[model samples]
Target: MPQNDRHKEREIPIEFDFYNTLESLPVDNRCTIIMISCGSTTVKINEHIQTVTAPAVLCISQYDNFQCLERTHLSAKVFHFDPWYIKACLNFENLDDSVPIDKQYVYDRNMLYMFTKHHGYFQGIFNLTPQQYIRLNELMLMIGAETYAQSDDYWTCRIRRMLRQALNCIYDIYVDQCKLNFYELSENSNPVTICTDYIHANYRNNISLNFLCELVHLNRTTLNQRFKQQLNCTCIEYLLHYRLKISQELLSNTNLKIDDIANQCGFKYGSYFNRQFTKYLGISPSEFRKNPTGYSVKESRGKP
Candidate 1:
């Protein structure tokens, strides 16, 4: 692979190789690393370890440590990017404020939050379906090509767009898998896990505390106490936050009407939704959609 000295720091760096590349890349906390296996292999990311076959994806946050525990018939492609690089390439402002930052590892804190809240079903390993694997592979190839080409005309914009699309693709796969696992674990998992999974799987529905209690076979008082004990928030509060988060994403990414977005996010009244959005974000949904970078949860709510 060819390297570009001019973009040695500015551009998002990607490595597409089988074995040698892994040995040369240091375990630095300056960037978030994603490793995609091209064949079946076993790997360790921090204390969590898993064995996945080809076309699987694993993400190592900037705060976590990683090592390749074992390798048999394994080939992989790895990509890493500094938080600032991801912010500049994707045009996300105040990304550091939205995500927790450390000297050791880089991460989009918002994205990691969503993954932990919604897609914790998979633990650490993200096993991709064959179709998703192919799409991600192609996207990685495009990113690699753009990095090597370093065209002065439009390559920078092209690379950013491709990188954003790849990230969105990975997110969609996680969401789909979470839904699948939700149904499969409906009968097997513990009450708290099941309740949380239910929220993730059906946040778009009009779910009330009673609905959650019935779904998880617990009474109102027990459910509330246990849920607060485990997640530090009542069931209803969690649902409200979940809806607000989804509404924020729709506002940032789409041109949908506020009312429509509210409806899609399970809010029965747009006015109520607007009030909650303003309360949590300290800005109207309209303002947030226009300039998402201006507001920071850390500054407003003092929380990630």
Candidate 2:
């Protein structure tokens, strides 16, 4: 595959390929990034098998480990690149060239760490938002364009840079990176911290007070107490705020319909989402999206 692209002997050995079929791509020591467009289907990556919803990404680094068990209404794009593509692309570090490719992640901190989050076993799936879906799909096209055209002396660099962004975007899709501090928490994290991290990661899911209790191994009263003491709100209230916080961003930034935004934020029903949003922010989502500054003009949001 690398032969198809502009191959300067000095440039890092990386190949780019695009496939429309939902089946797996063969990777010999290379990392394959599979971009599954907006649709739902069941697929097996190694021993892990689950129904993957639309607009998701899967990064696989093993050979002969991917199979499409079911491909109902599936569309995808796949990119294959050498595992050392990033490490070799680096000229700034005076590091040892003899470092083994598999262990190269030890020297590379963040980039590879994202891929090797669960070492040994392959982690092959990441959830993506609709906005993220559009951005990543575009990035794939750009990577293909640069690799095919060999636009300039820096085409490889451009692909590498955008590749980094795409990787980060899909992996960090649900994670609120602002909550990275949660990662520093000890294995025995406090109930509030555990609950907050779970909420942040699964805000779009059908999360509940009982689910939080089971996740943190605490009773409902104690869990609510911990959240109230630390955040001055109950667990459910915190979840609502997090969802609305996400809704606020989507409303202000994207041209998505209010109903679609509400559903994506886990509101089950659009009317309830509308009522709660209006009650909390003292304005309808449509009104807020239209004039975000309207909230400040109101004397009080809680009042009539």
**Candidate 1 lDDT, 57-165, residue by residue in tens:** 6655444455664454567776555444446333223334554556343444444432233232344456677887788778877776776677665665676677667
True-structure lDDT of candidate 1: 0.61
Q: Model 2: how far is 35 from its true place, Å?
A: 0.8
lDDT per residue as tens, model 2, 115-191: 43432223456667779889998999898778778867788789989887777775565255325543344332467
Residue pairs with backbone overlap in model 1: 29-104, 62-105, 62-106, 99-109
Error of 1 at 77 (Å): 1.0
Looking at model 2, which ten-residue stretch has the lowest summed lDDT? 295-304
TM-scores of the candidates in the order shown: 0.46, 0.48
Candidate maximizing lDDT = 2
Kindly state the number of residue pairs that clash in model 2. Answer: 1
Candidate 1 stretches with Cα past 4 Å from truth are 1-37, 89-109, 112-123, 180-304
